[model samples]
Target: MKDQGLSYRLTAGLEGYLDPADALVTALAHGGGADNERCLKRVTAHLKADVKEVSAFLGLVRIRELPRREDIELRNTAFLHELGPSLTGAEITGLYTELVRRTREAMQGRLGPRWAEQLAVHDLPTKLLRKRIGPSTVADLQQRLLRPDHVLLTDVSQRLSGVETALVRKLRRGAATDDVIQEAQMVRAHADIHRMKQQSLGTWPADPAIEADLDERLLLVARRTIRSHATDPRPANAIFDGLQTTLETSAATHDRWPLYARDSVLLMGRACAISDECRFDWGTAHESPA
Candidate 1:
């Protein structure tokens, strides 16, 4: 079931990237208005092709089917092949390295120091390893291994969300032709870790510690968004709506921690109030707060 869930999340993550990619491409193709639209169409087609290649690579990783290296020269050839023209060689290497680093970090966080050994024994390609480890041991190992994958999958999904958010922000800003073209070229570069950190906090894990953490993160994100977009009600409201939905969903799952839920709801209310005041000020004065 966990494997199935991972597969589903992987697909969802790819879809998350694709949906925004499509919107971005469409926006870019039309961003130049009718005069330059013909030229922009070629750019959009190239970006679409790039997205397809990246999607193929991500799909392979999703299924755990990435080809093993044959030699030092051929190392990461598959990744390079799939990401060509979209990313420089160094960028592709860095991206792969970041993925590996995140996977390791996830394992360490979930499995402690000896995660490599723990994962390796369970993932051994032979039935002999499992037989020797015994049924109970195998089951225990499998359960423990599931958590790292869950953490990794969640991280991937959150990064996709960040990309989508960035694209939406660009769209809301009435992205110029150059901005749209640059954005399309740098689609994978939009996964801001700082932004993702706040968004990632809303994931499930309904303990007191997690609840408190979520509350803090949500407030920080809301305050920052409100401050940055004080005069721009559209972007501020979009952010507020996303955060509100996240907080509400989180609050709903706090049957075991009603106080936490109450506090989160109150925090959200405070944010909304601040947003309302800012919007009112903007509307009345047509000026930003000093």
Candidate 2:
């Protein structure tokens, strides 16, 4: 039974890695030439790698399928000037496949595509993506940024919905805590953006102080999410579920004050005295859920 379960998980991972479109694009990418060699090399490398279980192998392949981009959301931010030429059908299909497959992974507690988008333009400075848009919207062009995986997903920006999850499974215990926190922040940001956009408020007070307060509170929650993965580690999906709950509650109490007020940040400043221990210690954080 354990063997069968492992096999099932492995196959699921492959489904994500070998998305039809990805395979198609890969095929076209080689144009029946060196690309084939590259694919073969990757497969050989995989075989030789010290992959313990089928799930590990499949997970690696899925990670490899993930698209790497400097700027996030090219279709939404910048798609006009010159980044790359038009994508062929194979290219388009490949991206779409990767995106959906990843989103599915996120659904299973990996953190999703929104996390990917967040990593692209978060407040943190890192080597992942380093292009700034000069305090302006790029609007789906390939100028300074490009859409991840070339998918037409201008709807929700939760790109890391599949992989932002903080987990020991993803790495050993020595992984950078800051990186996990940043990824969680990205997930929270996407959720907040979706809520704000759905409401379509023209001006909701973009005060730096207010935004910073909100971001901090969300960051705490995001950190908690990462911590969850540290334990039994159902962190990503758990955080996402908790996010949905918070959003619904906030939307309901958005107009109220104190008891349920607009000025109240859900997890932000003055909301709860969430100290360092509260942020990371699930036991302490949950002890007083009043």
Candidate 3:
């Protein structure tokens, strides 16, 4: 569930920064074989910023970029929370030493000689095990790191995936002359069906369908905003950036992880699916009326 939850959060994070159809069209219009790369770059930048903010809220410091490893502060805090204040120095030290030995052996067995050897010297727990820090703190850290991958929960991934699949199918069935609004409505309808399927599976949350009818609305807004800006000579890039910023700013207002996580995943994932399906359609990219 945590894995799914994380996937959901990632989807939400993406929604904050991405305008699926706009991103796709802009990238293709760039005409340099940089469509995917360019679009992803923008998305990645936004995701990283959100991740950094989230990590900071969770008490991680000194992160220059999104880290793959658990922060020492997090590990220490979790450890202390799990183990009470009754630990003695000898008991803590003993536990740390044993854990280090076991961890090294496990790493060595799984990762081969070089990594095991590298970890033997460089691992945080290994180093901390030898330190004369407070016993309660070390003892606490010991227990916490033993368990891994704690996270919030959500079931948006599968739902989002279903929406994606249906979106692609819908787009592939579409005509070149199809209005963007019409396509948006079709995509939103398919997303609704997927939402119902998720609900039927009982994996979806009991929460209101915050995502319902949003695809049509986002597309409509995008069409209007982009068209409204068309009078500018450099309208294309401005429209794309403006729409993206608007979504990102709106998503950031979620303030809390769960709300942002579920809403974002739903918003971005469906938006992206629609965009991906229609990227080459060129019909989804509406020009300003002359």
lDDT of 2 by residue, 1-290 (tens): 55676442221111112223356444533332123545545654766754233223333332223322321332211222112226544454455455445545544543345767766564644322223332232343233235454544332234334332222112222232455445445443443443444334445554446545554555555565556544333333444445435645564333322222343343322222222212232221122134
- Distance (Å) between predicted and true CA of 141, model 2? 24
- Per-model clash counts, in order, read 0, 37, 4
Model 3 clash pairs are 11-265, 12-264, 12-265, 79-140
Q: lDDT per prediction?
A: 0.39, 0.37, 0.42
**What would the per-residue lDDT of candidate 3 be over residues 53-129, giving only the tens digit for each residue?**
44332231111222213233233322322243355545544665665666555444333346456555745454444
**After superposition, candidate 1 runs with Cα above 4 Å error:** 1-215, 221-233, 252-257, 260-267, 270-290
2 against 3, candidate with superior lDDT: 3
Runs in model 3 lying further than 4 Å from the true structure: 1-210, 233-235, 252-269, 277-290
- Identify the runs in model 2 with alpha carbons over 4 angstroms from their true place: 1-201, 243-290
lDDT winner, 1 or 2? 1
The ten-residue window of minimal lDDT in model 2 covers 9-18
Residue 29 in candidate 3, Cα distance off native in Å: 35
Candidate 1 lDDT tens digits, 147-258? 4324333433344434333223233332224443243324322322222233446643546585455445545665554455545534433454455566666554432334
**Cα lDDT for residue 4, candidate 1:** 75
Sorted on lDDT, highest at the top, how do the candidates line up?
A: 3, 1, 2
Model 1 gets an lDDT of 0.39
TM-score winner between 1 and 3, please give it: 3
Which 10-residue span in candidate 3 carries the lowest summed lDDT? 9-18
